[model samples]
Target: MKALVFGADGFEDLELFYPYHRLKEEGITTHVASMKKGPITGKHGYEITADIAFKDVNSADYDIIVISGGKGPEKMRLDKDALEIVKNFFKKNKPVASICHGPQVLVSADVIKGRKATCWIGIRDDIIAAGAQYEDSEVVVDGNLVSSRNPGDLHAFGREMIKLLK
Candidate 1:
Protein backbone atom coordinates (compact mmCIF):
# COMPACT_ATOMS: atom_id res chain seq x y z
CA MET A 1 0.00 0.00 0.00
CA LYS A 2 1.04 3.60 -0.57
CA ALA A 3 0.41 6.55 1.75
CA LEU A 4 0.72 10.25 1.19
CA VAL A 5 1.63 12.50 4.12
CA PHE A 6 0.99 16.23 3.96
CA GLY A 7 3.17 18.49 6.03
CA ALA A 8 5.02 21.81 6.04
CA ASP A 9 7.26 23.88 8.25
CA GLY A 10 5.76 24.32 11.74
CA PHE A 11 4.06 20.93 11.79
CA GLU A 12 3.82 19.19 15.14
CA ASP A 13 6.79 16.83 15.31
CA LEU A 14 5.17 13.71 16.70
CA GLU A 15 1.94 14.15 14.80
CA LEU A 16 3.86 13.72 11.56
CA PHE A 17 6.59 11.31 12.43
CA TYR A 18 4.62 8.88 14.55
CA PRO A 19 2.05 7.82 11.99
CA TYR A 20 4.66 8.01 9.27
CA HIS A 21 6.99 5.50 10.91
CA ARG A 22 4.06 3.39 12.07
CA LEU A 23 2.86 3.06 8.49
CA LYS A 24 6.35 2.06 7.44
CA GLU A 25 6.46 -0.58 10.17
CA GLU A 26 3.31 -2.06 8.65
CA GLY A 27 5.09 -2.24 5.29
CA ILE A 28 3.26 0.68 3.71
CA THR A 29 5.28 2.81 1.33
CA THR A 30 4.82 6.39 2.48
CA HIS A 31 5.81 9.67 0.84
CA VAL A 32 5.74 13.13 2.33
CA ALA A 33 4.39 16.06 0.35
CA SER A 34 4.67 19.73 1.25
CA MET A 35 4.42 23.17 -0.28
CA LYS A 36 7.85 22.51 -1.76
CA LYS A 37 10.44 19.81 -1.86
CA GLY A 38 13.32 19.35 0.57
CA PRO A 39 13.49 19.89 4.34
CA ILE A 40 10.58 21.18 6.38
CA THR A 41 11.08 22.02 10.04
CA GLY A 42 8.66 21.12 12.77
CA LYS A 43 7.43 23.39 15.54
CA HIS A 44 9.80 21.67 17.97
CA GLY A 45 12.95 21.74 15.77
CA TYR A 46 12.61 18.30 14.16
CA GLU A 47 13.02 18.29 10.40
CA ILE A 48 11.73 16.00 7.60
CA THR A 49 12.35 16.16 3.92
CA ALA A 50 9.26 16.24 1.74
CA ASP A 51 9.40 13.81 -1.15
CA ILE A 52 7.11 15.83 -3.40
CA ALA A 53 5.41 19.19 -3.75
CA PHE A 54 1.68 19.65 -3.08
CA LYS A 55 1.04 20.63 -6.68
CA ASP A 56 2.67 17.47 -7.87
CA VAL A 57 0.70 15.01 -5.76
CA ASN A 58 -1.60 12.62 -7.60
CA SER A 59 -4.16 11.46 -5.12
CA ALA A 60 -4.96 8.40 -7.23
CA ASP A 61 -1.46 7.08 -6.70
CA TYR A 62 -1.91 6.56 -2.98
CA ASP A 63 -4.24 4.48 -0.83
CA ILE A 64 -4.38 6.93 2.07
CA ILE A 65 -3.56 10.52 3.00
CA VAL A 66 -2.32 11.68 6.38
CA ILE A 67 -2.41 15.35 7.39
CA SER A 68 -0.20 16.43 10.28
CA GLY A 69 -1.29 19.03 12.79
CA GLY A 70 0.25 22.24 14.18
CA LYS A 71 0.66 25.52 12.28
CA GLY A 72 1.37 23.77 9.02
CA PRO A 73 -2.30 23.15 8.28
CA GLU A 74 -2.90 26.88 8.66
CA LYS A 75 -0.83 27.34 5.52
CA MET A 76 -1.97 24.09 3.88
CA ARG A 77 -5.61 25.09 4.12
CA LEU A 78 -4.85 28.02 1.85
CA ASP A 79 -3.09 26.07 -0.84
CA LYS A 80 -5.41 25.27 -3.73
CA ASP A 81 -3.33 22.33 -4.80
CA ALA A 82 -3.34 20.87 -1.34
CA LEU A 83 -7.08 21.23 -0.92
CA GLU A 84 -7.68 19.66 -4.32
CA ILE A 85 -5.53 16.71 -3.40
CA VAL A 86 -7.55 16.26 -0.22
CA LYS A 87 -10.82 16.52 -2.13
CA ASN A 88 -9.72 13.81 -4.52
CA PHE A 89 -8.99 11.49 -1.64
CA PHE A 90 -12.45 12.03 -0.22
CA LYS A 91 -13.97 11.62 -3.64
CA LYS A 92 -12.39 8.19 -3.80
CA ASN A 93 -13.46 7.31 -0.27
CA LYS A 94 -9.86 6.53 0.64
CA PRO A 95 -8.64 6.49 4.22
CA VAL A 96 -7.79 9.95 5.56
CA ALA A 97 -6.07 10.48 8.89
CA SER A 98 -5.65 13.91 10.41
CA ILE A 99 -4.68 15.29 13.79
CA CYS A 100 -4.96 18.59 15.68
CA HIS A 101 -5.28 21.50 13.24
CA GLY A 102 -5.12 19.00 10.40
CA PRO A 103 -8.89 19.01 10.12
CA GLN A 104 -8.71 22.63 9.13
CA VAL A 105 -7.76 21.49 5.67
CA LEU A 106 -10.81 19.20 5.54
CA VAL A 107 -12.98 22.15 6.49
CA SER A 108 -11.44 24.20 3.70
CA ALA A 109 -12.04 21.37 1.29
CA ASP A 110 -15.70 21.41 2.41
CA VAL A 111 -15.54 17.69 3.13
CA ILE A 112 -15.99 17.58 6.90
CA LYS A 113 -19.67 18.41 6.95
CA GLY A 114 -21.85 16.02 8.94
CA ARG A 115 -18.87 13.86 9.84
CA LYS A 116 -18.05 12.91 13.39
CA ALA A 117 -14.52 14.20 13.98
CA THR A 118 -12.29 15.91 16.52
CA CYS A 119 -9.39 18.31 16.53
CA TRP A 120 -7.39 20.67 18.75
CA ILE A 121 -9.57 22.58 21.21
CA GLY A 122 -8.64 25.84 19.57
CA ILE A 123 -10.38 24.81 16.33
CA ARG A 124 -13.31 23.01 17.87
CA ASP A 125 -15.62 25.80 16.83
CA ASP A 126 -14.26 25.84 13.31
CA ILE A 127 -14.93 22.14 12.82
CA ILE A 128 -18.40 22.50 14.26
CA ALA A 129 -19.08 25.48 12.06
CA ALA A 130 -17.99 23.43 9.11
CA GLY A 131 -20.85 20.99 9.92
CA ALA A 132 -18.88 18.34 11.78
CA GLN A 133 -20.22 16.73 14.90
CA TYR A 134 -17.18 17.61 16.93
CA GLU A 135 -16.05 15.24 19.61
CA ASP A 136 -13.52 15.82 22.39
CA SER A 137 -12.28 12.26 22.41
CA GLU A 138 -8.71 11.17 21.79
CA VAL A 139 -9.78 9.89 18.38
CA VAL A 140 -12.90 9.98 16.21
CA VAL A 141 -13.45 7.76 13.22
CA ASP A 142 -16.14 8.65 10.70
CA GLY A 143 -16.36 6.47 7.64
CA ASN A 144 -13.08 6.93 5.82
CA LEU A 145 -11.85 9.75 8.03
CA VAL A 146 -9.95 9.35 11.27
CA SER A 147 -9.15 12.39 13.40
CA SER A 148 -7.47 13.09 16.69
CA ARG A 149 -7.21 15.98 19.12
CA ASN A 150 -3.47 16.59 19.68
CA PRO A 151 -0.05 15.04 20.00
CA GLY A 152 -1.13 13.32 23.21
CA ASP A 153 -3.65 11.40 21.11
CA LEU A 154 -1.17 10.19 18.51
CA HIS A 155 -1.27 6.63 19.76
CA ALA A 156 -5.02 6.36 19.36
CA PHE A 157 -4.83 8.27 16.13
CA GLY A 158 -2.22 5.98 14.60
CA ARG A 159 -3.96 2.90 15.88
CA GLU A 160 -7.29 3.86 14.39
CA MET A 161 -5.72 4.86 11.10
CA ILE A 162 -3.93 1.54 10.80
CA LYS A 163 -7.16 -0.25 11.51
CA LEU A 164 -8.76 1.51 8.58
CA LEU A 165 -5.79 0.66 6.39
CA LYS A 166 -6.24 -3.00 7.19
Candidate 2:
Protein backbone atom coordinates (compact mmCIF):
# COMPACT_ATOMS: atom_id res chain seq x y z
CA MET A 1 0.00 0.00 0.00
CA LYS A 2 1.02 3.57 -0.58
CA ALA A 3 0.43 6.58 1.65
CA LEU A 4 0.77 10.30 1.10
CA VAL A 5 1.66 12.63 3.95
CA PHE A 6 1.05 16.37 3.72
CA GLY A 7 2.95 18.93 5.73
CA ALA A 8 5.14 22.03 5.67
CA ASP A 9 7.48 23.87 8.00
CA GLY A 10 6.21 24.11 11.55
CA PHE A 11 4.61 20.69 11.60
CA GLU A 12 4.19 19.18 15.05
CA ASP A 13 7.15 16.80 15.41
CA LEU A 14 5.38 13.76 16.82
CA GLU A 15 2.15 14.29 14.93
CA LEU A 16 4.04 14.03 11.65
CA PHE A 17 6.64 11.42 12.45
CA TYR A 18 4.68 8.98 14.58
CA PRO A 19 2.07 7.96 12.04
CA TYR A 20 4.67 8.11 9.29
CA HIS A 21 6.96 5.56 10.92
CA ARG A 22 4.00 3.51 12.07
CA LEU A 23 2.79 3.21 8.49
CA LYS A 24 6.23 2.11 7.46
CA GLU A 25 6.22 -0.52 10.19
CA GLU A 26 3.04 -1.85 8.64
CA GLY A 27 4.92 -2.15 5.33
CA ILE A 28 3.17 0.75 3.70
CA THR A 29 5.23 2.85 1.31
CA THR A 30 4.79 6.47 2.34
CA HIS A 31 5.79 9.71 0.67
CA VAL A 32 5.83 13.16 2.16
CA ALA A 33 4.39 16.02 0.11
CA SER A 34 4.62 19.69 0.86
CA MET A 35 4.28 23.04 -0.89
CA LYS A 36 7.74 22.40 -2.25
CA LYS A 37 10.47 19.81 -2.30
CA GLY A 38 13.37 19.36 0.13
CA PRO A 39 13.55 19.77 3.87
CA ILE A 40 10.81 21.27 6.01
CA THR A 41 11.44 21.87 9.70
CA GLY A 42 9.07 20.65 12.36
CA LYS A 43 7.95 22.87 15.21
CA HIS A 44 10.30 20.97 17.51
CA GLY A 45 13.35 21.45 15.26
CA TYR A 46 13.29 18.13 13.47
CA GLU A 47 13.42 18.16 9.66
CA ILE A 48 11.73 15.89 7.15
CA THR A 49 12.23 15.99 3.43
CA ALA A 50 9.29 16.24 1.07
CA ASP A 51 9.23 13.60 -1.61
CA ILE A 52 6.82 15.51 -3.81
CA ALA A 53 5.29 18.93 -4.20
CA PHE A 54 1.59 19.48 -3.63
CA LYS A 55 0.98 20.53 -7.25
CA ASP A 56 2.67 17.38 -8.48
CA VAL A 57 0.70 14.89 -6.44
CA ASN A 58 -1.68 12.46 -8.08
CA SER A 59 -4.11 11.37 -5.43
CA ALA A 60 -4.97 8.21 -7.37
CA ASP A 61 -1.47 6.89 -6.78
CA TYR A 62 -1.93 6.52 -3.06
CA ASP A 63 -4.23 4.48 -0.87
CA ILE A 64 -4.30 6.95 2.00
CA ILE A 65 -3.43 10.52 2.93
CA VAL A 66 -2.15 11.75 6.30
CA ILE A 67 -2.14 15.39 7.30
CA SER A 68 0.09 16.50 10.14
CA GLY A 69 -0.87 19.13 12.68
CA GLY A 70 0.78 22.28 14.08
CA LYS A 71 1.24 25.57 12.19
CA GLY A 72 1.96 23.78 8.92
CA PRO A 73 -1.71 23.24 8.17
CA GLU A 74 -2.27 26.95 8.56
CA LYS A 75 -0.18 27.43 5.42
CA MET A 76 -1.21 24.19 3.76
CA ARG A 77 -4.91 25.15 3.98
CA LEU A 78 -4.23 28.16 1.79
CA ASP A 79 -2.52 26.25 -1.00
CA LYS A 80 -4.99 25.58 -3.81
CA ASP A 81 -3.16 22.48 -4.94
CA ALA A 82 -2.95 21.15 -1.40
CA LEU A 83 -6.66 21.63 -0.87
CA GLU A 84 -7.41 20.00 -4.23
CA ILE A 85 -5.33 16.96 -3.29
CA VAL A 86 -7.34 16.71 -0.08
CA LYS A 87 -10.62 16.98 -2.00
CA ASN A 88 -9.57 14.17 -4.30
CA PHE A 89 -8.89 11.90 -1.33
CA PHE A 90 -12.45 12.44 -0.09
CA LYS A 91 -13.86 12.13 -3.59
CA LYS A 92 -12.24 8.74 -3.96
CA ASN A 93 -13.26 7.66 -0.47
CA LYS A 94 -9.68 6.89 0.50
CA PRO A 95 -8.48 6.83 4.10
CA VAL A 96 -7.62 10.24 5.51
CA ALA A 97 -5.82 10.58 8.84
CA SER A 98 -5.37 13.97 10.40
CA ILE A 99 -4.31 15.27 13.80
CA CYS A 100 -4.43 18.48 15.79
CA HIS A 101 -4.49 21.42 13.34
CA GLY A 102 -4.60 18.99 10.46
CA PRO A 103 -8.36 19.10 10.20
CA GLN A 104 -8.11 22.70 9.21
CA VAL A 105 -7.20 21.52 5.73
CA LEU A 106 -10.28 19.32 5.64
CA VAL A 107 -12.41 22.31 6.55
CA SER A 108 -10.83 24.33 3.74
CA ALA A 109 -11.44 21.47 1.33
CA ASP A 110 -15.05 21.61 2.54
CA VAL A 111 -15.16 17.86 3.02
CA ILE A 112 -15.61 17.53 6.77
CA LYS A 113 -19.26 18.54 6.87
CA GLY A 114 -21.46 16.10 8.76
CA ARG A 115 -18.42 13.93 9.53
CA LYS A 116 -17.70 12.99 13.10
CA ALA A 117 -14.17 14.26 13.77
CA THR A 118 -11.94 15.91 16.34
CA CYS A 119 -9.01 18.27 16.37
CA TRP A 120 -6.97 20.58 18.59
CA ILE A 121 -9.16 22.23 21.17
CA GLY A 122 -8.23 25.59 19.70
CA ILE A 123 -10.06 24.74 16.46
CA ARG A 124 -13.03 23.05 18.04
CA ASP A 125 -15.28 25.88 16.93
CA ASP A 126 -13.90 25.83 13.41
CA ILE A 127 -14.60 22.13 13.04
CA ILE A 128 -18.12 22.62 14.36
CA ALA A 129 -18.65 25.58 12.06
CA ALA A 130 -17.51 23.51 9.12
CA GLY A 131 -20.46 21.20 9.91
CA ALA A 132 -18.51 18.35 11.47
CA GLN A 133 -19.89 16.78 14.63
CA TYR A 134 -16.84 17.74 16.67
CA GLU A 135 -15.76 15.32 19.38
CA ASP A 136 -13.30 15.92 22.21
CA SER A 137 -12.09 12.34 22.31
CA GLU A 138 -8.55 11.19 21.73
CA VAL A 139 -9.60 9.91 18.33
CA VAL A 140 -12.71 10.02 16.16
CA VAL A 141 -13.22 7.74 13.21
CA ASP A 142 -15.89 8.58 10.66
CA GLY A 143 -15.95 6.37 7.64
CA ASN A 144 -12.56 6.71 5.93
CA LEU A 145 -11.57 9.69 8.03
CA VAL A 146 -9.65 9.31 11.29
CA SER A 147 -8.90 12.37 13.36
CA SER A 148 -7.23 13.10 16.67
CA ARG A 149 -6.98 15.98 19.09
CA ASN A 150 -3.24 16.49 19.59
CA PRO A 151 0.18 14.87 19.90
CA GLY A 152 -1.00 13.16 23.05
CA ASP A 153 -3.51 11.30 20.93
CA LEU A 154 -1.07 10.05 18.30
CA HIS A 155 -1.26 6.47 19.55
CA ALA A 156 -5.02 6.31 19.08
CA PHE A 157 -4.75 8.22 15.84
CA GLY A 158 -2.18 5.84 14.38
CA ARG A 159 -4.09 2.81 15.63
CA GLU A 160 -7.31 3.88 13.91
CA MET A 161 -5.48 4.72 10.70
CA ILE A 162 -3.75 1.35 10.53
CA LYS A 163 -7.05 -0.35 11.22
CA LEU A 164 -8.63 1.40 8.26
CA LEU A 165 -5.71 0.55 6.00
CA LYS A 166 -5.80 -3.08 7.01
Candidate 3:
Protein backbone atom coordinates (compact mmCIF):
# COMPACT_ATOMS: atom_id res chain seq x y z
CA MET A 1 0.00 0.00 0.00
CA LYS A 2 1.07 3.57 -0.64
CA ALA A 3 0.61 6.56 1.62
CA LEU A 4 1.09 10.26 1.03
CA VAL A 5 1.94 12.57 3.95
CA PHE A 6 1.50 16.32 3.60
CA GLY A 7 3.04 19.10 5.63
CA ALA A 8 5.18 22.22 5.46
CA ASP A 9 7.47 24.35 7.63
CA GLY A 10 6.81 24.39 11.38
CA PHE A 11 5.05 21.02 11.35
CA GLU A 12 4.88 19.20 14.66
CA ASP A 13 7.99 17.04 14.79
CA LEU A 14 6.37 13.92 16.23
CA GLU A 15 3.13 14.30 14.36
CA LEU A 16 4.89 13.97 10.99
CA PHE A 17 7.83 11.73 11.83
CA TYR A 18 5.92 9.17 13.89
CA PRO A 19 3.29 8.41 11.27
CA TYR A 20 5.69 8.51 8.33
CA HIS A 21 8.09 6.06 9.91
CA ARG A 22 5.41 3.93 11.55
CA LEU A 23 3.58 3.52 8.27
CA LYS A 24 6.83 2.57 6.60
CA GLU A 25 7.50 0.05 9.35
CA GLU A 26 4.14 -1.48 8.52
CA GLY A 27 5.50 -2.07 5.00
CA ILE A 28 3.49 0.68 3.49
CA THR A 29 5.29 2.84 0.92
CA THR A 30 5.09 6.41 2.17
CA HIS A 31 6.02 9.70 0.54
CA VAL A 32 6.09 13.21 1.92
CA ALA A 33 4.63 16.10 0.00
CA SER A 34 4.83 19.78 0.73
CA MET A 35 4.07 23.16 -0.84
CA LYS A 36 7.52 23.20 -2.41
CA LYS A 37 10.41 20.92 -3.17
CA GLY A 38 13.29 20.50 -0.74
CA PRO A 39 13.49 20.37 3.06
CA ILE A 40 10.61 21.25 5.33
CA THR A 41 11.48 22.17 8.92
CA GLY A 42 9.50 21.21 11.99
CA LYS A 43 8.60 23.43 14.89
CA HIS A 44 11.17 21.53 16.96
CA GLY A 45 14.09 22.23 14.57
CA TYR A 46 14.14 18.89 12.73
CA GLU A 47 13.96 18.98 8.96
CA ILE A 48 12.73 16.43 6.43
CA THR A 49 12.97 16.43 2.67
CA ALA A 50 9.68 16.37 0.85
CA ASP A 51 9.40 13.77 -1.89
CA ILE A 52 6.88 15.66 -3.95
CA ALA A 53 5.21 19.02 -4.31
CA PHE A 54 1.55 19.60 -3.61
CA LYS A 55 0.93 20.67 -7.22
CA ASP A 56 2.21 17.34 -8.43
CA VAL A 57 0.17 15.01 -6.26
CA ASN A 58 -2.52 12.71 -7.64
CA SER A 59 -4.62 11.42 -4.76
CA ALA A 60 -5.90 8.40 -6.72
CA ASP A 61 -2.40 6.99 -7.04
CA TYR A 62 -2.21 6.37 -3.31
CA ASP A 63 -4.22 4.37 -0.77
CA ILE A 64 -4.16 6.86 2.08
CA ILE A 65 -3.37 10.47 2.94
CA VAL A 66 -1.78 11.74 6.16
CA ILE A 67 -1.82 15.35 7.26
CA SER A 68 0.53 16.52 9.99
CA GLY A 69 -0.30 19.23 12.49
CA GLY A 70 1.63 22.35 13.55
CA LYS A 71 1.86 25.95 12.47
CA GLY A 72 2.49 24.44 9.06
CA PRO A 73 -1.19 23.70 8.50
CA GLU A 74 -1.98 27.33 9.18
CA LYS A 75 -0.21 28.21 5.93
CA MET A 76 -0.93 24.88 4.23
CA ARG A 77 -4.68 25.30 4.58
CA LEU A 78 -4.45 28.45 2.53
CA ASP A 79 -2.98 26.72 -0.45
CA LYS A 80 -5.62 25.85 -3.03
CA ASP A 81 -3.67 22.87 -4.29
CA ALA A 82 -3.14 21.57 -0.79
CA LEU A 83 -6.80 21.94 0.04
CA GLU A 84 -7.71 20.17 -3.22
CA ILE A 85 -5.47 17.22 -2.41
CA VAL A 86 -7.26 16.74 0.89
CA LYS A 87 -10.61 17.03 -0.87
CA ASN A 88 -9.69 14.50 -3.53
CA PHE A 89 -8.68 11.96 -0.93
CA PHE A 90 -11.98 12.45 0.88
CA LYS A 91 -13.86 12.43 -2.41
CA LYS A 92 -12.43 8.99 -3.13
CA ASN A 93 -13.23 7.75 0.38
CA LYS A 94 -9.65 6.70 0.97
CA PRO A 95 -8.39 6.50 4.52
CA VAL A 96 -7.19 9.87 5.82
CA ALA A 97 -5.21 10.37 9.02
CA SER A 98 -4.68 13.82 10.44
CA ILE A 99 -3.30 15.02 13.75
CA CYS A 100 -3.42 18.32 15.65
CA HIS A 101 -3.55 21.31 13.34
CA GLY A 102 -3.73 18.97 10.39
CA PRO A 103 -7.51 19.04 10.48
CA GLN A 104 -7.31 22.66 9.48
CA VAL A 105 -6.62 21.49 5.99
CA LEU A 106 -9.72 19.29 6.12
CA VAL A 107 -11.66 22.31 7.24
CA SER A 108 -10.42 24.26 4.23
CA ALA A 109 -11.19 21.33 1.97
CA ASP A 110 -14.71 21.46 3.36
CA VAL A 111 -14.85 17.67 3.75
CA ILE A 112 -15.35 17.18 7.49
CA LYS A 113 -18.61 19.00 7.92
CA GLY A 114 -20.51 16.09 9.44
CA ARG A 115 -17.63 13.84 10.42
CA LYS A 116 -16.57 13.25 13.99
CA ALA A 117 -12.97 14.44 14.48
CA THR A 118 -10.42 15.65 17.01
CA CYS A 119 -7.65 18.21 16.83
CA TRP A 120 -5.55 20.55 18.95
CA ILE A 121 -7.74 22.22 21.55
CA GLY A 122 -6.84 25.57 20.06
CA ILE A 123 -8.60 24.65 16.85
CA ARG A 124 -11.69 23.08 18.31
CA ASP A 125 -13.63 26.19 17.43
CA ASP A 126 -12.49 26.06 13.84
CA ILE A 127 -13.40 22.37 13.58
CA ILE A 128 -16.88 23.08 14.88
CA ALA A 129 -17.15 26.15 12.69
CA ALA A 130 -16.45 23.92 9.73
CA GLY A 131 -19.46 21.83 10.81
CA ALA A 132 -17.62 18.82 12.20
CA GLN A 133 -18.44 17.28 15.53
CA TYR A 134 -15.39 17.91 17.74
CA GLU A 135 -14.28 15.35 20.28
CA ASP A 136 -11.80 15.66 23.14
CA SER A 137 -10.52 12.11 22.90
CA GLU A 138 -6.97 11.12 22.04
CA VAL A 139 -8.14 9.72 18.74
CA VAL A 140 -11.30 9.54 16.69
CA VAL A 141 -12.06 7.36 13.69
CA ASP A 142 -15.07 8.40 11.71
CA GLY A 143 -15.54 6.32 8.60
CA ASN A 144 -12.39 6.70 6.46
CA LEU A 145 -11.02 9.60 8.47
CA VAL A 146 -8.84 9.25 11.54
CA SER A 147 -7.90 12.24 13.72
CA SER A 148 -6.02 12.97 16.90
CA ARG A 149 -5.64 15.86 19.32
CA ASN A 150 -1.91 16.50 19.62
CA PRO A 151 1.58 15.05 19.81
CA GLY A 152 0.64 13.38 23.10
CA ASP A 153 -1.91 11.40 21.13
CA LEU A 154 0.47 10.13 18.44
CA HIS A 155 0.44 6.57 19.75
CA ALA A 156 -3.33 6.25 19.49
CA PHE A 157 -3.22 8.23 16.24
CA GLY A 158 -0.73 5.91 14.61
CA ARG A 159 -2.45 2.83 15.95
CA GLU A 160 -5.83 3.91 14.65
CA MET A 161 -4.33 4.79 11.28
CA ILE A 162 -2.67 1.40 10.93
CA LYS A 163 -5.89 -0.27 11.99
CA LEU A 164 -7.78 1.64 9.34
CA LEU A 165 -5.22 0.72 6.72
CA LYS A 166 -5.57 -2.90 7.59
| Number of the top-ranking candidate, with lDDT as the measure | 1
Worst 10 residues of 2 by lDDT: 85-94
In candidate 3, stretches whose alpha carbon ends up further than 4 angstroms from where it belongs are: none
lDDT of 3 by residue, 23-52 (tens): 999999999999888999999999999999
TM-score of 3: 0.98
Provide the clashing-pair count of each candidate structure.
0, 0, 0
Of the two candidates 1 and 3, the one with more favorable lDDT, higher being better, is 1
lDDT of 2 by residue, 89-128 (tens): 8988889999999999999999999999999999999999
Pairs with steric clashes in candidate 2? none
Global lDDT of model 2: 0.94
lDDT of each: 0.95, 0.94, 0.92
Answer with 2 or 3, whichever has the higher TM-score: 2
- For model 1, how does the per-residue alpha-carbon lDDT over 1-166 read when each residue is reduced to its tens digit? 8999999999999999999999999999999999999999999999999999999888888999999999999999989999999999898899999999999999999999999999999999999999999998999999999999999998899999999988
Candidate 1: pairs in clash: none
